[model samples]
Target: MMSISSRFAVGIHILSLIEFNKDGISSSEYLAESVNTNPALIRKIIGMLKKAGLVEVHPGIAGTKLARQLSDITLLDVYKAVNVVQKHELFSVHENSNIKCVVGRNIQDTIIPILSTAQSALEKVLENVTIEDIVKDITEKENLDKRHS
Candidate 1:
């Protein structure tokens, strides 16, 4: 199974919660409750988002909130900010395939260029999407859930 990093989703979720709460300084405990994650993990993600300028933390009693408008932020921005694998190929052939096989001998080298192109294409798509898009999606999903209930 291919593994996906949680940073992108988690960061977006945290930001969305902050946005939904309307500038309310959400504590790590509350975010952890919403995310079903440990407070320590929430704190860590918060720190990363804070460094990326995606969110702000008010020290002491008040905790955190988004630093800027959701529309101003893009999915690519969050992906990069949360430290997702950028410019990285989806898969790698760590083991050498049989050198005797014509394709195997050079497949790794040949794949690099293709992989680079694919990665660039993916990033291009990501750049076109923004946090506002995520928020809309989540809100719509929530509404659908409510209607079903």
Candidate 2:
């Protein structure tokens, strides 16, 4: 099964770090450290987020920040920011299916609709989850764990 690209998660991690450290400018190096990745990869993800209007990078300061309020940024928005999959389609159908095989001949017709529906379902879930929701959940879980400890 095709998986959602890691770029999406990295983009979210970058945004979360920026949100958590709103007082400080987020440089590519800083983001890379937080993500345990190289600066180039972080910058690439930052470029995608910038293009999606989810992040803003300052040339003079050489730093980045979230462009909008956390509550306004949905997971779907982040998903689109870094995901290159066509139309946010999660599944890649096997190409070069044998025409002579009945299953192969009808697979596209039979599977495309199901895949589309699955994608829609995922989109719906993502649409409901904003960055604020994620941050709050993380904070709450951490607090709960702290109390337990």
Q: Top model by lDDT, which number?
A: 2
All models: lDDT?
A: 0.83, 0.87
Task: Give per-residue CA lDDT, model 1, range 1-149, as digits (tens).
Answer: 86658978898888888888775658998888999999889998888888988888855756787788889988787888888685475656567689999988998888888888887788889899878888899889999999999
* Worst-scoring 10-residue span by lDDT in model 2: 83-92
Write model 2 residue lDDT over 81-125, tens digit each, in one string: 886566835677897899899998899989989999998997889
Per-prediction TM-score: 0.78, 0.85
- Per-residue error for 65 in candidate 2, Å, reads 1.2
lDDT of 2 at 14: 89
Give the Å error, residue 60, model 1. 2.8
